[model samples]
Target: MNREKLPVLLDNEIIEIRPDQSLLTERYTDFGINFINNLEKDQPFFFYLAHSMPHVPIFASENFKGKSKANVYGDVIEEIDFNVGRLVKTLKEKGVFNNTLIIYTSDNGPWLNFGSHAGSSGELRGGKFDVFEGGYRVPCVILGLM
Candidate 1:
C-alpha cells in the first residue's frame, strides 16, 4: 500500500496491516522474482511492479537506512536500485534476460514541495502538481528490445 499505516490487499483480501514499511521494496522485488522462477521456459508472462517508495512518509530497510548521502529519500532510492538489480539477476538466472522487455519509468515528477524529502526536477520548471514541464515530464528506460 502507498501508506505503510494502511493494510495491504491482495485479490481483495487483506494480506498485511501495518507491515514494516522499510521492507516494502524488498517484498515487491521478491514477488517479481518468485513469479519469474515459477514460469515455464516458453510461457509468455507480464509482471507489473509498482513500488511505493521515495514518496511521502519515506522509509528504508535497516540494511539501507542511513546508507545514502541524500538522506532518507536517497536511502529509499538506493533500496529501489538494489531491488531492481535483484530482479535483473533473477531474470538472468531464469534464462529470460535477453527475451524479456523491461520498462522503467516514474508516474510523475517529484513532490518538490516536500523540500529535502522530494526529488529534483533538474532544470525543469514546476513539480508534481504543477502545469509546467517538470510536472508532466518523467524519465523512461527500456531494455531487451532490439
Candidate 2:
C-alpha cells in the first residue's frame, strides 16, 4: 500500500505527529467547545467534529480509560459522548442550542481484526469488509434542531 504524504495543518501551520503517540478525541471536543464559546450569541456557526476513534488504533484519554465496562473501544465511545455533551452544554449556554444542529455519524463499519479493540455492528451480520448489514449499516445519531 502506497501511503500519500499528507500534511497536518492547525491554524494554517503544518505540524508533525509522532507515530507512537495516540490521537486523543478530547482535542476535537475542546476545539468544538472553543469554537462555540467564541461566537457571538446571535452569530451562526457550523462545527463539524469528525472523531478518528472507535475505529482502529482506538484510544481514550487518561480520564476515560478504565472507566468503561466494555473495553478501550467503549471508553473511546464514552469520551466522544462526553464531548458531545460538553458541546451541547456550550451551545445552550451560548443560546444557540435551539437553532443549532448536530449530526453524529461514521464513515464505515467497525474493523474487527483488532479483537477486543473493535466496535460492534450490533445485530448486523458481517463486519467492516463483508457486504452484509454490519459492513455498510453503521450507527448514526442526530441531535439538536431535528
In angstroms, the error of model 1 at 37 is: 0.6
User: How far off is residue 65 in model 1, in Å?
Assistant: 1.2
**Cα miss at 47, model 1 (Å)?**
0.1
Clash count, candidate 2 = 0
Model 2 residue 8 CA deviation in Å: 4.2
- For candidate 1, lDDT tens digit of each residue in 15-128? 989988888889989988999999987799999999989878788999998999988888899999999999999999998898999999998898998876888899999999
Measured by lDDT, the strongest candidate is 1
Q: Cα deviation of 69 in candidate 2 (Å)? A: 1.7
Candidate 2 lDDT over 41-117, as tens digits, reads 58876777777677676777888888899898888888888888888898888888889777778877888788879
Candidate 2 regions exceeding 4 Å error are 1-8, 19-23
RMSD of each: 1.8, 2.6
TM-score of each: 0.93, 0.85
